[model samples]
Structure formats: C-alpha cells, structure tokens
Target: MDGRSLWRGAVAAGITLALGIGNASASFLVPQTALPGKNVPKYRDPLPTFAGSRVPATSGYTVSFEEFKQQVLPASGGFGPTTVWGYKINGNGPLWPGYTVEATKGSPATATYVNNLAGPGGTPPLLQKYLTVDQTIHWADPFKLRCMFTPMAAGCFDPYTGPVPAVAHLHGGEDKSDFDGGPEQWFTPNGMRGPAYRTYTSAGAPPAPANGAVYNYPNGQEATTLWFHDHALGTTRLNVYGGLAAFYFLRDDRDTGRADNPIRLPAGDQETEILIQDRQFDTAGQLLFPDGFPSGLNGAPPNPTVHPFWIPEFFGDVIVVNGKSWPYQNVEPRRYRLRLLNGSNARFYNLAFIDGVLRSAPIWQIGTDGGLLDAPVPIVYPGRLLLAPGERADVIVDFTPFAGKTVTLTNNAKAPFPSGMAADPQTTAQIMQFRVGTTVTGDTDGTCDPAASKKSGNKCVLRTTPMVKLATAKGTTAPGVTVATRRQLVLREIEGGGGPLEVLLNNTKWSGIMESTMGTTNTPVAGSTQLVDYWLTELPTLGSTEVWEIINTTGDAHPIHLHLVQFQIMNRQPYQANKYLSDWMAALTAAGKGPGDGPPNPYATVLTDTLSIGGQNQVIGGNLLVTPYLQGSPVPAAPNEQGWKDTVVMMPGEVTRIAVRFSPQGNPIGGSVGYSFDATDGPGYVWHCHILDHEDNEMMRPYIPVKP
Candidate 1:
C-alpha cells in the first residue's frame, strides 16, 4: 500500500479536531452477544472461564455484567498499536454470580452489566454498576458503553466531564429493538438515581452515564456469534477505545439442516470459532493516535487535550483471538469448521489460510450472526470478506493436510486503513495465528465414537436457532407483498457551524428519552415506545418486492445494513471521500474541500450486504432486493437476522434501497404469525446501522409490529 492510499484509506476517527473541536461538545454519539460444545465429556463451564484467561490476573473483581465500570486514567499512553479497555471485565471470586462464561445450545442468556465511569475531570471511586436495562427513557437497549472511562491522547484527562453516560448494544443479533441494544436505553451510573434516564418525553435532564444496570441482552436469537460495545450519546469513539468490547456465542442445539445429510467433511473438532481484532498502543504501551488529531475529523475543533487515543473504528495492529493478542491455537490435522469475525473497530481484513490453497475454497461459510447459511458455498479465491466495525463472519477451514505442519492464516489488508487510518509495519504487517497440530487423535478428547454427526461435509449441524433468532421469531411478512409503506432513512452528518460530530442515522440527537416522535415518520407504537417498520406493505406475502431508499446526508462513506435477511447489492454512485490529511496543509490541498464544499471521490457500491460505503461526498447510491428463502411470516419476521443482528450499515452518501421480509423462518407466513408471541417483555425487533456510534446518536429508531 502506498503512503498516499494508506493515508486515504486509514485516517484517525475520534480526534477532538483543531479548527472547530476546541469548544465543540463531543457529547454522546454512539451505538453499541454465547456458546456450547459437545464432546462425550459433557464439559461443564465454571465462572472463571467467563472472566477470560487473564481475568484472574487483571482488575481482580469477578463482577457480573452489572458490576463493571469504565476506567479513567490520570495519564495517557503515547502512540503505538491501539490499546483496549474491556467493557465488563471482572475480578476473581470463589464462585461469583453470573461471572462465568457459559455456552450452550437451545438455552436463553441474559446480562445486567453497568457502568460507573466518572465524567471528564472525575476522581477515583467513580464506578457505579447495578443498573438494569428495564428502566430507561423510551429506550430499547438498556446497556451502556462507558466513554468517559476511555483513555485519551498521551497524558490527557478531562476530569471535568459532562457525563460518562452510556448505552450499549450488540451490533448484530436477531433480537428486537429492546434486546437489540439501542441508544434510547442510555442511562447514567445511577438508574432512576441519575438525571433524565427514563424513557419519557417530558423528562428534562442533565447528562449522566448509565451504570451496569442499564444494559442487558436476552440472547434468544440463533446460535451465531455476536459482540457488545458502548453506545453513549456522543462519545462512542472514545468509549469503545477505552476498552469496552467482547464476543458472545449463542449455541444452537437443534439442526437447521445445512450440513450434508449424506456427505462428509474431510474432519476434526466438529466446529470452531475464530476471533480477530486489532489494537494500537502508545510508546508507553498505550494506544496510538494518528497524526493531526485533537480535532477528530478535518477542519474540526480540536479537543482540549492532545493525546492520540484510537477512534471509533478500531482495527488494531495485532490480531486478537479469544482475548489474547496474536495468540496461536494448536489444531489437530482434520477439517475444522471455523467461524470468523472481524472485530476491528475500523480496520477491514481480507483473510486467507496459507495452507495448500483451497480446492473449491472448501465450504467456508456456514452461519452468520443470525444463523447458518442455507448451504455452504465453495470459496473460489480470497477476495474481500469485508468486516465493518462491530461486524462478524462465522466461517470454517479444513486443516486436514496441514495437521503436523504450521500454516499461517494471514491478512494482506493494508493498514492506516483504506478509508480510516494508515497502517505501519509494526501495526499493519503483523500476522494472526492459526497453528496446525503436531499430533492428532481420532475421536479426540479421549472418547471413541461420541455421537458422530449424522451429516457429511459439515462438522456440526445447527440443531437450533440462536437466541437472537428467538428474539425475532414471531411473524412473517406476507409474500408477494408490494409497497404498503415507504419511509426514507437518511444517514447525515454536519460540520463547520457545529452539528453532530460522528455518525447519525437520520437527523436526530441521541434521545436520552422519548420525543415528539422517536424513530422516523412511519414508525408504530409498541408497549410504550416507537419502532421502525421496514416492511413494504403494498407487496405480496411470498414474492413481494418494493423500492426502499437510504439517503446518505453525511460527508463520509458509511456501510448501511438491513437486518432480518441478506439482499443483492444493486449499484452505487460515487462522491468525495473525507480528506483529513490533505486538509491539514497550511494551504488547501488539491483534494481538500474548503470547509463546507462537499468531499471528493465518492463512488456507489453495488453490494451483497457486506461492502463498505465510502463516507461523505455530495451523494452516493446502493440498493438490494429482499428474497426470502422460506415463505410467510408474522410479527415482522426477518429470520435471516435471527442467527443474530439488530442493525446494519448504510454507507455515507448512499441511499441503500432494499425489500425486507417481516417473517419467514420456520413455517409459512400465515403459519408463523402470532403463533409464539411474547408480549410480556417482547421480541420487539428492529434494524439499523452497524456503525453503532451513528445509531446511538439518534441515528437509530425502532421496528414494531401491528398484528392482524
């Protein structure tokens, strides 16, 4: 990658900015998932495992999701690979409650994490956990992401902060808006104890960070992997950088039937999950900031402090697996089904295993955040497997021949990122480890034939749906439906005179509570909140098709997504990309837009649901057609997202258009509707941008169902 392209692709995300950020209020701008394995052993998981390998050594408290708080440091670390601060890390305990990481098939999971981070200029003992998601102002996701706890540039600390107010969300999960983790649920360390933390339109309030009490997940969707992150009002970038992220694998015990019923995979551990992420550290082993920061984006006001902490999109220097940086896993020489996730904040990875190349690329793709693919598609070559921030890929790899030999599963994606930050050898050139085994044992873990899979080709058949799947398991969209409703969702951003800083779904501030209208125009009322209705009413129940438009009103490119199912990327139009580096020159550079003049080089992307939408420009375009594999759904069933997903991305300047199915997973549209309804709490489903920061800052709305 050339220096120029490197800089172009990769730029700093969360700097304070110099031109306008000086006095800019970087308020809440944010958005923010479990498993089981079979073995004859029936291995039981204990509490410490959930703390992660290093849980015992670090922090020291084995708190549940409710007891953790974001941290604030008096000093900052200098530039290097970006650093991370875990969101709900716990200290040790003899047998603490809910501190253990438990993975199982066909079971429900819940979390009650909290944050006690102090606002800028806060002192120690700032932690305040125990907040639950059930109590929030017109909110959906009650969990919060603690940004105030995030570390700033080298040696910088904003002791006097407005609030560490947080709202967390699992980017993609087949849950409803409630469990989907939206910003409306934001709260301060104090639940009702804090200001304006409940969901009421008339509630006047000051800023406050929600404690661990605000956030929760009802992992009831499919058995796909999901992630968690901060979703504060305006400080999303800062919060996530402060180290609030992790993975949750929802295990499916029931079979979804993708594996070959009569065939066989060449075999080893029936299935595997691969975790990948990047980080930056300062010279003092802290996270690094790109050059020309303090001011987040171009011509923006500079932050009062000058440390270079990482931004919202975190594609770190080293690869992280499980939780260790560049850690290698010893494998036995057999075909292993591997699930991969690009857990980088901003970086995109094009993955390829360096074994004897792939034969038809093997049946690599199996399941996604929601559920397993209908069937495995043979990989032809290593093209782009784009991973947006907070996105994931559940895939597989065969190590049949490379068993005794060490094969490197490496990444060739350039760093500083192509659209975000530049990469250095120290940061970009590092390799993610996937070491082959030195030994192999048949029937593995000391067992002979422990219930061999009935299917061939695939290791594990998805026995059941993931929790997120259950979240949206209600109804189906009547097929062949036309346009009953058409609403326009635009992603917009403002600079110069001081508008919202980072991403925005539509044009709304992160509603600490409810407002005149929370979501968009066509939203429906559910329980006591508003929801986004992504259905085209005029279309038919089985083969309905409608035109949906997603307007990108921002200057930078963004990747827009639709939950519930996958669509075909129709086309894209180009606009200018944000030029942060060139704009820094004393004189305006060629590509640099003077203040308010739009951006340069904006281009449209015809996507397949997994492409990056370039940020900012005059305009851009993208489209998709929702085609349900199965027919008929009730309660707005988008079963495809059930493997897991609540929101997706619609890149900057692009109006992503597509048709979506409300229901259609298990049975026909009529058969599924209102069959298994849960009105007590809800499976109130929704969809939004995967770029959580944008969603939290009122970029997200809601999706509700008005049953027949």
Candidate 2:
C-alpha cells in the first residue's frame, strides 16, 4: 500500500516506439513564419456574439453540432478554408466560436442539442474519431469494462472504435445531475449510446429526442461567465480541441439591475467577451492534434510501445482569438471592458499589452471567474495578468492613451506553467494586435456617476468608485464563525511501466466502490488491498461548512476543480513534505491503504472550486524522494484573487487550505436558504483538473453529496 511501491519498477526501458493498431504521431507542423501574420486578409470582419435566440427561462432553443468553414488564416498563408465543428442556431452557418446563451437567475432555460456531424470519408466511412483518444487509459467503452491488476483491481473501458460520441457540460453551472452533462452520458450520431445516457426531462415528461438531449439549465446561482464544452469520456480533449465550446452568462439583479443594482458595469457593445484558444493546422487546412500513440517523449522516444501517441500536455503554436489565427481588432480610443476566457487545452497566459517595448498601458482587473470584485485592481505597466487554462479575468483596458499607435497583446507564460520551459518568442509570445482608430467614440452613457469613472470627467463607465465586492474571505475562518468539519486530501501521479500511466485523486480512480466505507463492509474485494479504483470518499453534509486541505505531492502544478459549488481560499502554508509524506505513507501501509488514506485537515476559509496546487522542485531518485527544493516561505493569495473564486492556483510543495460550504445559508456574506433543487441525487457530480488533457486521462474523480 506504500505510494512508492504502487509505481516502483513500473517503468520498463527498451520498449519499441513502433506503431500499434491504433498508434499515431504528428506528421506536420506549421511554418515558423505563419506565426504573427498580423497583416493577413481582414476577412471574418465583425466578430459574432450569440445573445441567445430566445430569452433564457422563457422558451427552449435548439443548437446543432455541425461542421463549417472559416477563413482562419489569410489566403496568402495557403491555409485555406478549414472544416471546423461549431454550434448553430436556426440552421445558420459559420457559427465559429459558438453563440453565447444568456439566461437570468432563478429561471430555467432549455435547449435541444443535436449531433449532425458526418464521419470522415473513406472506403466505408472511417467514422470520424478522436485521434488522441488513448485506448490504454480508462475511457467510456460501449462494450465491457477492462480491469487491470496491481495491488487492487482497477477498471477501464475499451477504446471507442466507432463514430464520434458527444455531450455538453455546462461548466460552473449548478444544474441537476441529469442535466450536468456527465462524461458517461454520451451518444453517437448513429444512435449508439454509452451506459449512463439519460434524457434531459422532468419526471413523467416525454423522453428527450433520439441522439440528442434537452438540457435544463437551472440558473439558480450567482451570475457568472460559464461555458459549454464536450464531456464525452475519453475524447474530451479531442472534442473541445475540435471547436465545440461556447459561453453562457447568467444575469441577476445584482449584476445588471436598474436602481437595485449597486454595481453599474459596462453593457452591450462596450463589453466584449472573447474566447482565447491555441491550435495547430495541417498544411491541408485540417485541424491537427498529437497522435494518441506518439513515437517519442520530449524528443526522445521513451517507451513508445506504452502510449504511442499520448503526451502529457498539448501546446499549440498558433494563438487563436475567437477562432481566428492572430486576428486583429479595430478599437476606438476609449474605455472598453474585456471579458477574457482561457479556452485553451493546456497553455497559460501572462497577458500584457505591449506597444513597442515591454509594456505601455495598464490593465484594470475588475472581476474574476465568479464575477465582480470588491474594487478595481490596477495592473500597472509591465504587469502581467496570469491566467491558467479554464481561468477567466474581467478587465478594462483604456485605448485613449495609444490612439494612433498599434499595440499588441502578448503572452509570456511558460509551457506546462510555472516550472516548465519558457514559451517560444515567435509563436506563443504574441497573441493579437489592437489597432486603435483615430475616431473618438466618446462615452454616451451620459452619467458622471463615480461608480463608473476613474475621475470626474474621464468618462469610464466601469472604473467606478466603491467597486462592488461580492464575496471575500481569507484566513483560517470567516470572522466570528466556526467550521463544522475538516478533511485532508492529496494529489498524486502514478507512473507506469512506460511512463506516467495515470494520475489519481485521493489515490483512487473512477470505480463503483464507495470510499466513505473504505475500511468497512463496502471496501474492495479481498487480495485487492490497494486503492486504485474510484470510490465515493467525500460525502459532504448539506447545509454545513468544512475545510479541505489539498496536499500536492507531484512535481506539476495541478488545477484542482470541484463541481456544484464554489469555494473561497484561505491562506497557503509550507510544510515538511518529505517528513509528512513518510509518516503518511507509513500510516497508509499499516491500514492496508494507499498513501491517500488519511491526514489531518487544516482549517482555513478560502472559497474556490478550482485551485492550482503549486509544485515543489523535488527530485525523484531510486527508492528515495528528496524535497530540498521546498521554498522557505509560504505563498499568499494574489490581491486580485481575494474575491470569490471557483478556482485557485496551488503552488508546488504548498498546502492549500480552503473553506467550503455546502449550502448558501451558511455563507459568510448575507446567507440564503440553500440550493433550489436536491443536492444529493442521481449519478452525482465530479471534480477534477480543468486541463482538458488531464481530465481525459486518469486525473479526474467523482463525488456525491449526502444529507447530514
């Protein structure tokens, strides 16, 4: 049961990188000059914004998953019309960067999503499939479950060998389990379905349409920027990478009201919502992804026979803005609100506006993933807005100062994040260019309200005074409060005979065993003493508050995400990881469990559903793990990150303490009764890394909430 023994001697050298039956590798790469092609054809002129065909909660709408063409790059670049999949309303064409669905709080919205895509062409129709679906990993197989034996029996599904399966998950939504768009609820275009398929309907209602689902989105939580993306089991990375993601916003009286709203933020055209993604295109103008069975690792083929085309991370060289490569936008010299969402698979962005040199303009961050902050935090010149994949930042950028000059938005974040190699200058460095026109589009709001201006007459609508702070809680606990429960969990990466075979959440995979009864009668069968299969370990009591301490033992900084609820972050502290791990492993071995069995939870009050666990600079040697690279000091939450957040970054070698509540009635702020629907029900919910690749692998798990 020792963590070291679970993966010890798993890596067997000398495995050939030969192509298996389903192995693949990258065959092409875009020319280096193709990057920063800022002067490409000015096609796809006005970026499209979907405001929803019908007002949310009023009527149901339909979106068909179909393929279309877009002038992604200039024709001069020879990358002609590329066939990409997107959501279309009313049978419209070219809905790249799918339309935004708008809904109001407390109202329920309905939508029928249909899969109308055709399989790839071939002798008998090759059945368009996920080129990066790792068959060796645990996935959604239509047939039976395959179990691998180690200390315990761990199960996975066979590789999907048919037409592409698809489903949509409304990330950040608190919808019912039936409408949550779980990974197992996938359906193929030919009517073939997975095991967990369900019709999105109420009790006694008619079943959902065949090969489609009628999703009921209960907009019962705070108004925030949520997105819909494919959650099909093993191929999530390939599907989302194939352009099946869009935005959805839930509005409320607080976020947008007449007199009752305390915060009067920018609205309409003044506010621009953009989806930022990274991609690579083949010379034939087709979407390109790394072959599931690659022939090499970090340039040297390491046990290619293991996972031929599977790589730990996917980094694209081209910066895609709203589906256009290195696209440019013309802006009038004034204050404009930018809602930036990192929709990429793995790339992180340290965003900044570069004129000619390093920095020119300041970016004022007013909101985060969960919405408005207490006040605007000015990111001064040369400051970088660090955004991890799946993270969002709402900011106001003033173009008045650089009216005639062209400023380029740039990124400097390293690949694989913090400790990875620096990003390439020519490709990942430049994002998009902003051409500030000489025309002055003055603020027409006609309000001198201090809540919307930097000064008396500067005329900034959202740079208001007394910025609205929706939620803020930092420290061990909220002022004048007590925590009902506390628990500790660890994140680990398990190596295989080839390389990293899988990553585990609490040292468990997605299985049927209930972790809440691990040592009891519900535990795994005899002789299977290790914890490798998924078990329901965390069953938080409804209407209660608890502290969760996430301990990261791996080398990579993982973004930990929870479902159904958002949490606030407390403070992060450094620990003697080496000593603690040794003791923890000993305890687990004695109990006949893995290293994730038990550890005392630290009490801290911070809110977020997704947090980045900072990685420590540790060296892994034979039977000896050293942690001398641990930082001497603890890391604090960023100032802009003190507000309510669904996700936070946990640095390596750090213990991130978060205070989470099951019901809103126990909120630190003015409380509400609770959720509108039942918290404990159906297939339940899951929490995992927001990184698409990791989620597709073994880095995700499921948890169910139960009544107290």
Candidate 3:
C-alpha cells in the first residue's frame, strides 16, 4: 500500500451507548393505505401504471386496509406452529424457528408463520390466546404512506388489544423513513405517534437518561423479500412468538426480473417459498415460553425467573412448510427460486435438499438477506435451506436435472449446528416431500450449481466486485491495523444459574453505559439516536494493514458479526475443550476434558459472512487495508465491501480470519492510516451480529474513522 499520509481516519460513534435490554412490548403496525372503493381489491393488471410489466401479479386475495379486523383475520386464524423446520445459514451454528411462505402466480398469496418458542418445561399449546402478553399484528408486503391498525390486546395475549406499541420494517425495502421500520420509529395500539423513541432505557444504567430511543432505516434501497415484526425493548422474542409477524415482498426487479432468472417462476407446484423454522406445541397447539431473562444476559435482574423451557433457542421434532407438516408439494420439471428466512430466537441451520432422502448435494446460493450475488456457489444440498435468527437467503434449485423423480427436502445439519447441540432422536428425523411431475414450469433454464448449500459461508457470490477490478488491486495483501496500532476484542460468557444462553463481545453484557462502565452488558442500539463509544486509531495516509485478533473465552458458539465490510479468513485453531470446561463449568464437567487446538500457523480457509471459533489456539485474526471512501483519498473500494453491505457474522471457535479495507473502495482513511465516513442524521450506519436477538440483547458496537 502506498501514496498517502501516515494516519488518516474518521470516528462515527454513538450507536453503542443507546440500546435497551428490558422486556419488549412491540408488535405489528396499522395499515398505510385504503381499500379499493369496490368490495374486491382494486389492483391493476396493467391498469394505471406498470401496465405491461411482469412483476408478481399483485391481483389476488389482497385484503384492503378497511377490511382488516372484520372480514379477513379472525377468519384466517392468529398464530401457531410452522409447517417445516430447516436451515438458512447451515451447520450447528445459529438457527431459527423455520417454516415456508408461498407466493404463486395466480393463487391467493398467503403465509403461515409459526411460533417456535417453547414454555413451561418445553410443552406447547393446542389452544388460543397463547401467552400472557397482549399483542396483535397487521402487515403489508410493500410500504405505503399510511399505517395499519392493530388491536394488540384483543388478539392472543390478555386485555385483548390496547394501544400496543408497534412498527413495521420491510426487512428488505425501497421505502421512506416513515415506512422503514426502526425500533424507535414506533407507535402504540392506540395510535400514539410515529417512530416515537429510537432506543429504550435499559435497567441498571446510571440514572438520568437524556432522551427516549428511536430507530430509522434506509428504506430507499432496492427491495429483497423482507418481513414485518415486533422490535420493541427486550421482549422481541416473546412478541414474535405471540404470532405478530408476516412476510413481505418488496416491489423490485427481482420479482419482475423472474424472466431472466435461471430458476423459472412458478407455473405450477414445482416452486414454493420454503420458510424453515422450529417451534414447540403446547398440549393445546399454543405457542409457549417461560418468562424472566435467558441465561448469559449481562445485567439481567436477580429475581423474577418465572417460566421454564422456551429457552433462548428452539429446535423442533417435526418439519412443516406452507401449512403442511412434512407435507409434500407437487413439482414440475423445472427450477424454482426459494427465498429462505431463519425466523427463530437462537438457532443455526445447515440446509441441503436431497435427490432421494437426506442425501443429495446442495444446488447453489444466489442471494442473502442483502440480495443476489453475481455468480452462484455450490454446497451440500440439504434439500432444505439454512438460516440464523433474523437471517434470510434467496436460492435457485433446479429440478430439471431430477425431473420426473420423487425427491425429499431433508436436513442433516444437527442442532447446535456447527455440530454441537445434541438432538432428540424423534426430532432429528425431520423431512419434507418433493414429488416431481413430467410437466415443466417454463423453460427450465441454466443453473450455476452442480454443488451448493449453506456451509463454507460465501462462495456462489464473487468475492471481488467491479470496483476491485478498476483500482487494479489484483493480488491481495493481508488486512491489518496501523503498523503501530492494534485492537483486540474478547468474546465472553456471563454465567449465573441455568445453562448460559448467549455470548457477548468484550466481556460486556448487553446492559450498562459505555462512557461510565464500559462493561460488556452495555451495547448501543442500531440506527437513529444511539450515542456510542468508538476508537479510531491513526496511521499513514498511504495506509498500512493492521492485525485484529479476536479472542473468545465463552462456552457456546457465537457468530461474532461486524457490519459494513467482508474479509478473508486468515487462520484459526480450536481452543482446548478441557480448559474450556474447567473455566466454564463445575467440577463434574472437568472430569472429561480434551486437548485444545489452534489453526496451523497462517491457517487459511474459506471466505464467509461468519467464522466459527472454538477454544483451541483461542485466537482469530483479521486485517483491514484502510480503504477510504473519500475521493482523492488513498484507500479505494476495490477490496472493500463494494456491494451494498452493513453486516457480517463471525462464527464461534472457528478463529476465522479476514482482510478488510476501511473504505469500501481503497485502503487507508484519507492519506492517513485511519479515516471515517460522512455522518448524516439518517444514513448513520452501524454494524453487529445479523442475529436479531443478539443485536437486540447488545453484542453490537459502533465505530467511525476521525481526523486527528
């Protein structure tokens, strides 16, 4: 790296100091549009605009804003278990309560969301009004200028619909702040206001907070299939379990661009949205969960540990999809586009669809929560998809190769993916039916996968974008901090009673304040009004790479995620299992221990959004070529996250390594070794684990490059 000053950088801090860890009360928002003047939905085939377009025909079963509570919902039923449970990311890593969402060409677009939360010793309910909370929801696939009305207390929880607080985030959207769902940008069941508070004041923080919290999103980005759900306070997991969630289909070329897709649109049964998730059924088919704090929370209170089961994570005993339990869908001789989301609290899935039983290679990976990648990568076909909580992926599976044959979408990625969590025998045999018909959907087009599924993380997508090509940064240099500057982040586990629930960054729990305590528990909120603590070290303008070694001292696996950039896995080693047990548990646990290990010197593996770091060697390495976004600045976007990005995950015990540039384009901030991005009140970006629960619970930190 050459040409610039010896230390250029910017600091954008404020996100780490403003997050809430209290129990949540969030739910769905009100409608944003009026119903058609006529009884039926007044949608245009080519009516007003989009006359001759071929986007998903938005003409079927659209319930207008007015007819919400009266005609549609009560008739549609409230909440229940998912149809199938699979993976979105893969392995025994982070998983989600899984299920399927289907949007056909002509059939009524419908989705059956499942609540996989378990309660009172892991039993589920077969009855109504699932929990003790009062919550309800209404969703729109697209963001309109209006809000939807919801009777929070009246639906499932008690007091039936009150003015419950709420908001909607089309996970993937092209909308406005008024429409982009932010934690702060929320309203109550009684229609209190719009996006009132961005951050929630957590318990145990120093008294006298300055302001309420609120969040805002960049709604103007292109659309990818997203969803609307509750994100208020700490109880996000519970509210979603109450059945206050829905699927979203942002209006975009992805839908209309179906023609160009290697996987054909649904002409028949060959295609369907395979929403895989896990859930527990009470004696009455009702969703269940025990109250109080999950294990491992930083500043969780001492008393009130009610509720049992419904642990931080859930893995099911059955598979469901599109309202059918291990049900089979008829498929034509064609390929299909499967958009997968991991809707769960804390579970990781390693998905692969099989040609026969649970034994086929993966097809390919074309998209992620962000959007489609240029090329496709191959994986072991789980005949299913993998996803972590709040994670999603867009895939294309070709049935043309296996035309006229009966196949099964089976899963072998055992629980605690990354292969750790033990599975109950009955729960491990989950499978779904995929019968192929002689009929082809359309021209069963070309495919990019002879192999692919959710594993080795990033493949199908090209690591280098056009930006990298232009800068002429052909061969690569390892990423690093300024030669004289280095930073180390420690992954810790805060233990108390039951098994540890989650891991934390830097020993801090998702509680407290950054300026005062600077403890592990204190993490700032994401987007809008989160004042945070950050450090931007300085160096040369011709920026030099720095070494960032992340150490983990926790028991459970953690996907230490960072936002805004992607890096290469430099090297990794497994920590000694024996030492881990001794440090993490009682004497009984120490009886059976094993030798710890680390990646061989300069260990190099695959490139992925996440890196799993076990106890061995206990060291994870990373480097960043200070790529600056400033024009005329030395760092370029070539090796930076040229594609639109804001988040990436690091798996547990994997000791993953990566190379990152400060600027999405070049190296070094300005002519210095450090620099920052321009901060606007709105687009002020932050990063954290893609695991929504982790982000909510505080495992997120913020940073901004600054000029000295």
For 1-708, candidate 3 gives per-residue lDDT tens digits of: 110110011000111111132232111111011111121111111101111221231332111100001111111233233221111211211122211122332132221112222223333222112322312111111121111122111222111222233443434332222223344444442234332233322343222112112222222233345555554433345445433444444434334334444233332232345555454432223233332222221112222121111233344443333223344556665666566655555556656666654346355555555444445544543234545555656666666666777666555554555555553424433445566778653554443332445363422333234222111232223222322223334454444365544444543323212212222333222111232222211111112333344544444455444333333333333444345434433321342311111111111221232322221122221211111111132222222222222222344553323333443323333334222322222312233444444444444433333222
TM-score, model 2 to reference: 0.80
Candidates 1 and 2 compared by lDDT, better number: 2
Give the lDDT ranking, best first.
2, 1, 3
Models ranked on TM-score: 2, 1, 3
Per-residue lDDT for 86 in model 3? 19
Report, for all candidates in order, the number of backbone clashes: 235, 38, 200
Which structure is stronger by lDDT: 1 or 3?
Answer: 1
RMSD in angstroms, candidate 3?
Answer: 17.0
- Index of the highest-lDDT prediction: 2
**How much does candidate 3 score in TM-score?**
0.54
Name the runs in model 2 displaced over 4 angstroms. 1-57, 90-94, 120-130, 145-159, 203-207, 254-264, 292-304, 442-474, 512-534, 582-636, 665-672
For residues 161-254, could you state the per-residue lDDT of candidate 1 as single tens digits? Answer: 2334565555554444444444444555444222223321112321222354322333444455555566543345445545455555554434
Displacement of residue 95 (Cα, Å) in model 1 is 16
At residue 492, candidate 3 shows an lDDT of 49
Candidate 1: residue 22 lDDT (0-100): 40
